[model samples]
Target chain A: MASNTQDAAHGAAESAPGMPQLDFSTFGNQIFWLAIALVAIYLILSRVALPRIAAVLAERQGTITNDLAAAEDLKAKAVEAEDAYNKALADARAEAQRIAAETRAEIQVGLDEAIAKADEQIAAKAAESEKAIGEIKAGALESVKVVAADTAEALVTALGGKADAKAVAAAVADRMKG
Target chain B: MEGDIAQLGQFIGAGLAAIGSGAAAIGVGHVAGNFLAGALRNPSAAAGQTATLFIGIAFAEALGIFSFLVALLLMFAV
Candidate 1:
């Protein structure tokens, strides 16, 4: 049985010519090193590097989200501020218009009052001038009557040497009547 | 010994090529998935970035295809 096993092994070795014997010991060593390398790589990635990288990435994502939310809030606030500004501007415009209208009305009233006062003053001055003219005309007419009566009495006195005083007076009255 | 060494070399090369192709495919898939997600989120930006995405995929696929070609050459032509 031992001889048979030896012959079988030799035949198997001879079948693949120029093939070296399998080095199981070397294969084992290669496998052990490969395993060590793989484990080291895994440990470095999982325990040392990957955790730190993950933490950094997570922090970056958190910062990004917070910035986006803050931007949205700022946008809302800007819209609110813009709305308030527009409302205030519109209110100011309305107030200005109202004031303008009131000022215009006041100006119109003042102008009307001034015009009425001027008309009253003109009417009073015209009435006073007419009254003054009437008084001057009456005084001039009375002075002319006195001057004419005195001249007629002097002429009658010069022409009535033989006439009585009562007759002369009666003649003057008759002439004045004629 | 020479024949055994040659066979081992072939096996290692084939394994490396296979692993390289698999990794390239996974990397390409990840890039594609992210591109699609970004495109869906912003369709307007998708049009501008489409050419770049395709270029990146082509480059990765070229590497994977080259590895396959090398494996085929080693297996058949060699």
Candidate 2:
């Protein structure tokens, strides 16, 4: 194994090229190329891509924040609108109740006046009827007295006796007293 | 026949170096897997950690690339 390795080593040493990465001869060139590549990439990213991405990110953040604030404002406005609506509803209800009470009072006043007027009319009609009845009774009594005097005088004349008018009147007056 | 031993050793060394690539791949997988686990656990925080996830992945992948470069050097330049 040692002989074989020595022979392999001798063969490899005969050739000039070995691990090219380790070759000091090309290090300067590799470093120069690497520097150029790094600078080019840095310039492209800094000048173009990075700034645009940053601007876009900043704009997106701003938009999100503004949207949140707008939503909050709208929420507050909604609450305010609800409160106003409630207040208006309460006011309308109260006004409606007041109007209803006022109308009820008006109706009550009108009803009371109507009843009083009807009672006064009824009482007046009753009094007038009572006066008329009393007059009719007085007229009937006077007629009955005159009729009795005539009937008594006619009976006495038919019987062939004198019938004094004053006497007949006195007798009728006594019967009426009973 | 005389130089075959040296060539064999170089091939063997390149093969060994290539194993590092698989190890690096495992490291990259670990980074991605952990990031996914964390992201799934707290999805709300996932968006903010995306840059960190990518940085982890890039570092793991860079190691794998370095291993591959070493394998290539062993095979061709050594």
Candidate 3:
């Protein structure tokens, strides 16, 4: 087995090959150095550089997200303020309308009371005048009846007839009724 | 005469290997040019792709270095 392996390697080990890279004698040395360099680079990058970069990127992302959330919060507050202002304005308008309505109602009540008092005075005055006219007519009729009774008694005596006071009153009252 | 022919062949192979360096330079330029075009189209995304751009440049440059090493080996060691 050893002789067969030596024979297979004879072309590479007989002398220096056309290229140093193809020389089997240096292959292990080159591979060892390459592996060492690769391991060193990997250790430096993974242990020190990559973690720091990742942390910085994460922090930046967090800052951006916080700023966006703050902006959204401020916008919501602004909308709330606008809604409050509109509600206050509507309430003020409603209050003003209610006040105007109350004032109108109060004025109307006062005017109605004043008009009713005036109408009552006018009605009372009319009733007083009618009562006075009725009293005056009654007094005039009484005076006329007295005068008529006296005139009839005088005419009966002047005609040479016996004048009866009671009869003369009865005749005057009956003629007045007609 | 045999040594002379081998030396001639090595010189020719070394000259041919040098052409790979130029090809690698073209590949690097193509990668960089496409990256610039994309970056110009969307400047906002340019910063994020910078690492990728560097990786592509390094890979293309490595090929050029490899070709240069091959040419040197042919000229000196072979």
Which ranges in model 3 have alpha carbons more than 4 Å from their true place? A1-86, A109-178, B1-19, B36-50, B70-78
lDDT of 3 by residue, B1-78 (tens): 123465567567888999999999999999999999999999999999999999999999898989888887776565
For model 3, what is the alpha-carbon lDDT of residue B13?
89
Q: How well is each residue in B1-78 modelled by candidate 1, as lDDT tens digits?
A: 223455456556866777779878987998899999999999999999989998989998888888886775444333
Candidate 1 interface RMS: 13.4
lDDT of 3 by residue, A1-178 (tens): 4454344245434566745566788999999999999999999999998999999999999999999999999999999999999999999999999999999999999989999999999999989988998898998888898898888888888999888989988888899999
Pairs that clash in candidate 2: none
> Deviation in angstroms for B62 in model 2?
4.9
TM-score of chain A of 2: 0.50
* Per-candidate TM-score against the hidden true structure: 0.42, 0.51, 0.37
For candidate 2, give the docking quality class from DockQ. acceptable
* Order by TM-score, highest first: 2, 1, 3
Poorly placed runs, candidate 1 (over 4 Å): A1-28, A123-178, B1-78
For each candidate, what's the DockQ? 0.08, 0.24, 0.10
1 against 3, candidate with superior TM-score: 1
Question: What C-alpha lDDT, on a 0 to 100 scale, does residue A72 get in candidate 1?
Answer: 97
Model 1, C-alpha of A177: deviation from truth (Å): 30
